[model samples]
Target: MLSPTLITVALAAAMIGALAGVLGTFLVLRGQSLLGDVIAHASLPGVVAGFLISGERGFVPILAGALVSGALAGLSVQLLRRGAGVKSDAALGSVLSLFFALGVVLLTVAQSQGGSAGLTMFLFGQAASVLRADLLPMAVVGGTVLLVLVLLWKEFQLVAFDREAARAQGLPVERLEVLLTLLTAVTIVLGLSLAGVVLMVALLIAPAVAARQWVRGLAPMVWLAALIGALAGSGGAVISAMGQGVATGPVMVLAAVALTALSLLLAPERGLVARWRRQGAARQALRGRQVLAALRGLEGDHATPDYASDEAMLQAYLGTDAGPALARLYRDGLIRPAARLAPEAAARRWELTEAGRLRVEEGGQHA
Candidate 1:
């Protein structure tokens, strides 16, 4: 029941998402996540210029402008960081703000001139308006970016994980960095028509961040991030098509955020819920061992047949939560109440069973 145009738009968005996800993984690992944001915002001025020069909304021209603008912005950040001694964050922020403001001013001028009326759509993206012509450019650019990433995978990974080591090996670390930055700039440019400047950062980084939580290896993380980003892009497009007045970019970002939240709560090893469960099990095991150790210690110290078996003594020895441990130990035949104890006695004495003594002697209690 879906229309052809809608299908094309969805596919383009997915391609953009997959490309962004792959490149963004390195950005996240290199601690340059904010650099992605800066590149995205910086593309705006070039986009506006592209429209002005072409005098129409042509995907290729606009994309070319975007690529140039984005690269300059990314290079500016690097120069400021390395040459001017500006902090990385400050450089990124300064360039991002400056380019975005310049783009805004150009946008206003173009709007007043009355030739670029539809230019505002690129500000937040209008995926619903994507045409067949848009798909070709997206496929060509996205495919090229992906191919390059694969060809330089080892170099990029080396630089990202350990720059000092890469430099020690004489691996041309600075060239690799610049290449990676340009790659990221291209990605942001490609995504401009789909997710825009602001939402594109979320598209770039969220899937990678989410995938990192579940995966330890770089290869697995990259593929998983691409898959997740594709899903968000396609799903957001579909949802926007079905809804009224809803923007495609924001919806895609929300979908990515939702997946991230799910990963945070449910992923193994690092998830909040998993960590809580593990800690609870560990505490229980520790308490059980403590009770066993306490029972073993009391036998020789007290002359009352075995030792203090009363709730009061156990509580004093192991805090107020000793009852559960005591009950668990008794169930395991590690400890039991002393013989001839009154049923109504408030403080019945207890002793460790033979199994309990052997367990303590062998250090099995620590197990």
Candidate 2:
């Protein structure tokens, strides 16, 4: 029995997630990931500045202020890059610190004026406070952001993968780069407006990272990231509704955290656990092959016939590293061990069963 408000909040969160994912993918692939974080954190001061000037709390003017400030932060980083020798990371860090510091100062000033409880909400975002009125803006902006992202996909890929080539191809590398920065800023600001600057980066980044693990192409990545974002948002909204005083922003972030961890361990090729397992399997196969070659050497059987001679030859080839794996292989019918042949164990060589040869071929494909 979820409320309509909770459902709307979740829908909004999912849209935001999709927008973040779309631009976030490009940011990460282009190695500008930290910039997104910088922009997200930097937007707080803009929000406070907006509130100070407009004397209000809702998204309209505040988000406008956020966009202005966000763009400035993005532009400042670019100016730093062009005007000074400061590297991108340093420039981004400098902007983040300066903007956030300014925000804190503005917030302090605004709080001194009157009831600060309402003003403080922007600092950590009160997503559960979101109403149906907020839906149209999120939908409008989110839709525009995604449409532009898809239309410019090819250009972005070139710039991200090979800047020099994009330049050589006359793809407006520099312009597109700035345009991307602005998009990243906008996307970040959207999340910051809901999740607060502190957790904004998670919303903008986690879904994209998770999506990357699942897809090879850009389109699927964006879609998947959006789905995850929406799910997290909706789930957080539900949690907040049932629990007394549960913060919506933090709950959304926690849901994102779960997805991020799941992707890191379970997502296809790029997952942490998957890679580790692949490496372990590869190492075992290599050792098994070495043992087979060694067995052939000890066999003195020029043609190296079959599985009957493995027991005696295990001593010559199989060692501590392969003992457990080899034993498992034996039980699985991949290999026949020489262990049963005691005397003249040199002739007691292991032989590859059909499964072992297929494994070897599979290894060759990888090579």
Candidate 3:
């Protein structure tokens, strides 16, 4: 029941999302997320220039123009950092603002001349404009990016995790860095039509971030990120198709963000909920140990191996609530009620069991 146009848009968005997700893993790991933003915003002038030169909104020319502009922006940042003695952040900021301002000015001129109709869609994206014919090129480019990544997997991994170590091992760190940047530029250009210049960075970052929460290894992270990105893209496209006036790019971004939030809250071992549970368990363990140590101290003070202390005595010694800790220790067979109690004793007393004494001894040794 679906139309061919809607299907094509969905496929295109999915491909773009997968590509962005894969490339974004490296960028996020390297702390170069701003680089994606720089490339995305800086490519705008190239898009306008491509349209101006071709006098049409052709994908090839526009893609070529954007690649060149984005590559130049990347190189400019490097040159500023090494040649001009500027900080990395400063160079990126400068190049991003300069290229984007130029792009805005060029877009204004093109609009005034009345030849830039529909070209403005790249600013926020218009996935409905994608045609079936565009799918082949996107597939080819995306395939090539994946192939190159596969071939250079180990080298890229080395560079991403430790550039100095890679260099020390005689790897071409600079060339690898440039190649990664180029691949990123290509991915960003491919995504411009689906997510647009403004929201493209979100598509790049959100999926990778979400994947990171669920994975620790680079390989699994890349695979998961690609899947998340594709889902966001396709889901957004379907939602946009169902709505009357919704935009595809924003919807896709929102979907990706939602996925990220879910990952942050629910992923095992790394999510916020998981972390809170671990912290709570750790506190409980520490409290149990503290209680055990307190019982041992009370026995030592009385010069009696079976000396027993009531809950009030433990609380007074530890200056905190001891009931929960005592109950947990008792549950674990680490402590027990004293064997003997005076007839007039108002409260029952507790003593450390053999297991509890051994646990305290082990903790002391480790400490």
Candidate 4:
């Protein structure tokens, strides 16, 4: 019970999201995330050129223009770094700003001219403007890109993890690098109508980052990212369909960001809450051991049964929070308050019970 327009928009968005997510994983791992953003921004000028050339927003012309612009931007980053001795980040920034500025100028000029109705849609996307004809091309491009990604998985992994090692292995490192750049261009160009060039980087980065928190392996990460991306895309489309003036691109980016936040807070091993729990447990365990060890040392000094260590002594060894650890130790029966302490001591002292002493002895032996 979905409208055809809704279905078309959802399918196209999902396709674009999957492509961006898969490629974005490699970009993230390679420490070239900014490069993807640069490519996206660079594609704007091409989109403008396409609109001008075709006198309408034809998919093929815009895509071709974007691909060409995206490729040049990718190459410029490398050439700037290698040939001109510029820093990598500086080169990416240069290309991103320069290309985007040019695109903006072109866009402004196109707007001043006639026959540019809804052309600004490429800036932030006009999901409602998508047609059923767009779905097939999106599917074809997305499937082809995925096929290429699967085929070059190993080569991409090698280059991403260690480019020097890949080069040493004679694996055509330069070609792999270029291949990745081209794929990145394709992803950026393909997503222009979904999120637009301006906001497309969020689609590329957020899903991969969210997936990274939940997995350790590259392939699993890619799959998870793709799923998250697809969900974001389809969900955004559905949500936008419910409202009269809802924008799909921002909604999709927000959805991806929501997934990232949830992953950061709830993912089992890498989540913030889980890590805090682990650290708290570890500190509690350490404090318990410290208290036990203090008791053992007191016993070694001939304060075994009658004489107990004072809180002052324990606090000196542990920090100010020793009170909680001491309370826990006593509650656990690992230590007991002394029946009698030296009259000179003002604070209550502690001594290990027989069970506590044996436990400490066993721990020492193991260590």
* Each prediction's TM-score versus the true structure: 0.92, 0.85, 0.95, 0.90
**Deviation of model 3 at 15, angstroms:** 0.8
State the lDDT of candidate 3 residue by residue for 106-170, as single tens digits: 99999998878888888889898789999999999999999999999999999999999999999
In order, the Cα lDDT scores of the candidates are 0.85, 0.75, 0.91, 0.85
Lowest lDDT 10-residue stretch of candidate 2: 358-367
In model 4, which residue pairs have backbone atoms overlapping below 3 Å? none
User: For candidate 2, lDDT tens digit of each residue in 167-248?
Assistant: 9988888789888888877777777646887887777777778788888876777678878877777777677767888888
Which residue pairs clash within candidate 3? none
Cand. 3 TM to true fold: 0.95
The better candidate by TM-score, 1 or 3, is 3
Report the candidate with higher lDDT, 2 versus 3: 3
What's the lDDT of the predicted structure labeled candidate 1?
A: 0.85
Model 1 regions lying over 4 Å from their true place: 303-305, 330-333, 337-340, 346-350, 353-367
Query: Tens digit of lDDT per residue, candidate 1, span 169-236?
Result: 88998888889899999888777777888789998899999899899999999999999899989888
Give stretches of model 4 more than 4 Å off: 300-306, 310-323, 330-333, 336-349, 353-367
Ranking by TM-score: 3, 1, 4, 2
Q: Which has the higher TM-score value, candidate number 2 or candidate number 3? A: 3
Model 3: ten consecutive residues of lowest lDDT: 358-367
